[model samples]
Target chain A: MAEYEQHDHDHIEHDHMTIPKYIGIFLVLVVGTILTYFAATVDLDFIFPGANTLVALLIAFTKMTCVMLFFMHVYWSPRMIWLSAVASFFWLAIMFSYTMQDYLTRDPGVFSP
Target chain B: MSSHSETGKFHYHEPGLQHQFEDMGQQEESVSIGMWMFLVQEIMFFGGLFTAYLVFRSKYPMAFAAGSNHLDAFWGGLNTLVLIVSSLTMALTVYYAQKSNRNMQVIMILLTMAFGATFLGVKTIEYRDKFNHGLVPVQGWNKRIKAETNAEHETKPCWEVDHNAPAIEHPNPRGEFQWTDCSLVKKAQDEGYLTNAEKIGYFSNGEIDANKFRDKVRIFYYLYFVMTGLHALHMIVGLALMTWLLIVAWRGSFSEDYYMPVEMSGLYWHFVDIVWIFLFPLLYLLGRHFMHGG
Candidate 1:
């Protein structure tokens, strides 16, 4: 099994991405960006207040996923690599969640200076 | 190293593996894991700034909205597109590196650098516009602002203040224009906009006296400078890394087996692009009900 895995790993041709797939991902990314710009341009506050920011963030998240999955090869990478990549974001979430606990409740007057 | 390659027991030879590693696969895996670890630290670093920005923006929503309106979205959008294109080129550079296509790899890297430079150029133009409007934060700058604001009381736009025009000094413009909560009291009151006791310049003695309000909006500029300034610094570092990559790549140093440099730098570039992805929307899209004003 170790020998078989080495044979697969040492060959670059076995799992490399083709040019067309990369080009397709690029085009999709461009469209996602344009869609995000349009979403920001139109006010959606009447549907629900803060909907505009909501829309912008959702579209940005979509675009980021595209970059991560295809451009960064997270989709095709092994489980170990995927875990490493996901761990970074998980740690980032922890940092944000804990910091915001203190930040969101702080009195406005605390920043008067 | 030569003996290990001849024995064929090591799939990846000793030259690719440092003495401490069992083999090249282990060495490469650790390197990959290490890069991700570094990127995690980077995310946390930027997370602190974003958190601070969020807290201030929540506390001062209207001020933030007004600040957001002042930024031009078209240029910000253009930068977003440019950065996305740069990421595409960068990813392609990595692809070509893995294929051992030296010329295409070099070309893609140069194209990425060009887009990065273009992003910086657009940013410089935006910064220059802000300076011309006297929006930069400098100590004692509000003194000039007071004279300029008072001079503009005669239908002159504060942004259009002439250096040659005679200066009229207003007593305590900082205190006069800025109060505890009132953003534009004298101007808003004159414009017949009803205000609560906050906009009114009242001291503890019940007498109307300027205490401090003119510089509250400057906080927005302070945040803007810190965020975009750090971003520009990152672009500078990315450019320097690209220059080194260019030299080594031109020397035919990268190939299918040795493409770690290209892959690592591509990760860094995409990370920067992702940062801009968040920034463009938050800063440029926030209170632009429509600058077209149609």
Candidate 2:
């Protein structure tokens, strides 16, 4: 595999997001943020025990995807760019998995708990 | 870096190209790819802290929740809103930069910088408040200061103040707890929700054991400072980059043909925004409702 791409970046149509579309995404992001704030203060745990972290993380992930796909122009990007974006998360997962192996399974009281 | 001038194909050569690439499109893609690579490393850097935060927060849910609540959600939430708006302007700046619209591009970049400054401003206020209360994670930081300060709002609790103009709570044993539900525990005890032994274990002299909470609270501040401090540092870097871009844009540097700087900087700015999107919930919103009892 080549380190650099061969495709003409200029020849390719750069489907830049329209101003209105960017505004719409911004509105959604704002609303999603407010919702994330409120949802944290609600007892989602009552609905399903220990789901607050899950709900919070899920919302965060959604917001992250929006930013990446639209704000970062990932949605209009080519395969290499998309793969690069996914690669970052993949690397993050590696860090999380190995680290959590020790953290989640370790003795909780080791930290003066 | 190789001399990009001599080795290029029959190309739309721009002023910024090094002696390394085939053409402008390839050069721009290379720049974008390089930025993403840097961003990947950035994710790892922050990932280390997030992992530590997760480990500790899980180990000390009560302390973490209580510590998280000490932070003013209004400021954190307002900063989130501010950053998102900044991101919109940033994306617009890049868009106009690609169109070579100098006025809109400069305006949007300025707006983005203003928003970024606003975020740091709000952060400075929060940091000052924490410092005033001695919430610094290192030496001279009073680990108990937050709980101590929050204890003064015993009747209304700290959050009730946030619902209003959010008057500052003082240091007093009775005014304890920022989460609304700690007051509930007090209420439950008052109305006799617990058995005598439970009351004895959970409370002593009609108050929760604030001493038992010291270490966890300290850990919370450690995570808070490491994460948010690093974030603020990134904002500072972004602001510096924006200042550079603003100066160059003022000199009629970027155009539809050569706007790599604007695009790359926008990516950096958006990456910071995305990190905050995750950070806000993890740091500010984690366990907010469920840990209300904390």
lDDT of 2 by residue, A1-113 (tens): 44234444453345568899999999989989988888888877657655887887888898888898988888877678888889888988888888778766655354322
Give the top-scoring candidate (lDDT): 2
Name the top TM-score candidate: 2
Q: Please give, as one word, the docking class of candidate 2.
A: acceptable
Q: Which stretches of candidate 2 lie over 4 Å from their true place?
A: A1-9, A107-113, B1-16, B141-209, B290-294
Q: In DockQ terms, which candidate is top?
A: 2
Q: What is the C-alpha RMSD of each candidate to the true structure, in Å?
A: 6.3, 6.4
| Per-residue lDDT over A1-113 for candidate 1, one digit per residue giving the tens place of the 0 to 100 score | 24534533543231456788888878887887788778877868679766888888888888888888878776766577788778877877777778768766555454431
Minimum summed lDDT over a 10-residue window in model 1 chain B is located at B175-184
Per-residue CA lDDT of model 2 for B37-107, tens digit only, reads 89888988888898888776655565666677778889999999999999999999888877878999889
